[model samples]
Target: MVVTTELVGLIHMTTRPFHNLLLPRIAVLLVLGALPSCAEPAAPVHGGAGTSPTQKSRPPEKRPDSSYRPPRGFTELQSVAGRVARASGHKIVWRLQPGANPGPLVRIRGTVNDCTIFVHPLAARKVPPNTWAFLFGHEFAHLTENLGTHSATSPENELQADITGARYAMAAGYRIEAFLGWVLTEPDQKSDSHGSLHQRVRAIARKFGVPWRTIERESKRAASYRAGR
Candidate 1:
């Protein structure tokens, strides 16, 4: 009987009640640890151990104005038009015909359907014969590419035309860079989606490294021809 009673007493001790107050302390020990000798967390092995790649390194932002634009010329732009027109593959035909208003001060760069390239003169002094030729070639390329239809808003295409302008002038044996310096201009409000003036100017200038003095000397070709020179 004594052995049986002792067994019961041990069972009672093993089944003793757990107080609510003891749980918090146990939880704290499990979380924080009771031992004061716990080592400090080891320093990170590498500086970028846990960061996302994007968070670790940011990409560069683009500036809207980071484009090219050449300076404005003093003389009327029509002068360059004459020279450009004279140099184009297809002869650029010009005539003083007043018509229904199409758009603002924008030039009609190429012939729409007609085989012979033509640009409507804004005024008699509009784009002189020479300047219009190169512009005509540019427009002709555009017409060929169907730019007026498919990629009208694309900035890159217009830039290609700018390059074409300088190229045509060079092919005509004129000083390409000087004419480009004058010809590289803005599209006014109509050209919002186009690249800025500086970028266009630079693209042309980079292509035609023709000397500056050549441009100045040939400046008079605005109203006159220099052997398509």
Candidate 2:
């Protein structure tokens, strides 16, 4: 998912400053429109022809932010982002925000050369490492491919991200099934900008050559594991 600083206006219009109280100064551009909620996955598109090839390049050095103290387990998340970024041949600046209900994993493009991803603390703690690869991989696709910049709607943008992200994560050595399982957990709602969960599942399944039954099995296993925990 992607968002821009215009969210400030949205906050004011809704009189709901609490939702984005800690939003950074960075200006984020969302080609896929405003996301409904953190749990909601971004939109979709068909075909794999437009996917960008991964170029070999050095990962960008971390920019120092004295006010930013790395949260516990942040290093691990950074590692996941690094793996995805390397596989996509894009430099990403990863950041964690302090909040119980912060936004989804979103990519912020301050400029053509600057791309950053921000996630909630809860997401970092609750989502497993393999799933993180999928999440970051999704945002990495948006950043590298410059998706939604043209006439694509939210569903088109999100579907494209799903396909590209799965490829990048797979290239980075993460299981594609993990992403399908994660998608199964999302609410199956079809919105103006995003597709229903089932639609996304089918799209991703077709793209990765994975069976829908396999994804369903993984989802059940994940649920059982969580229940046991």
lDDT of 2: 0.53
Whole-model lDDT per candidate? 0.38, 0.53
Instruction: Assess candidate 2 and give its TM-score to the true structure.
Output: 0.62
Off by over 4 Å in 1: 1-122, 126-128, 148-151, 184-192, 211-229
Candidate 1 residue-wise lDDT, 1-229, digit = tens: 1110000100011111211222344456557765222133322222334756654464333211101111022122334445555655645454212322221222343243333322222222222333433454555455444444222345676667657654665675544544443343222122444555545555566666655555444444331331121
In Å, residue 37's CA in model 1 sits off its true spot by 99
Per-residue C-alpha lDDT of model 2 across residues 1-229, encoded as one tens digit per residue: 4443111100111112222322321113123444223344322211235533331232222321111112236666777777877787656554433433444333333322455556555445445667767766766666566665312346777778778877888888788775576556554556565556568778888877898888887777555543332
Who wins the TM-score comparison? 2
Deviation (Å) of 195 in candidate 1: 1.2
Give residue 85's lDDT in candidate 2 (0 to 100).
Answer: 75
Q: What is the lDDT of residue 163 in candidate 2?
A: 83
Lowest summed lDDT window (length 10), candidate 2: 6-15
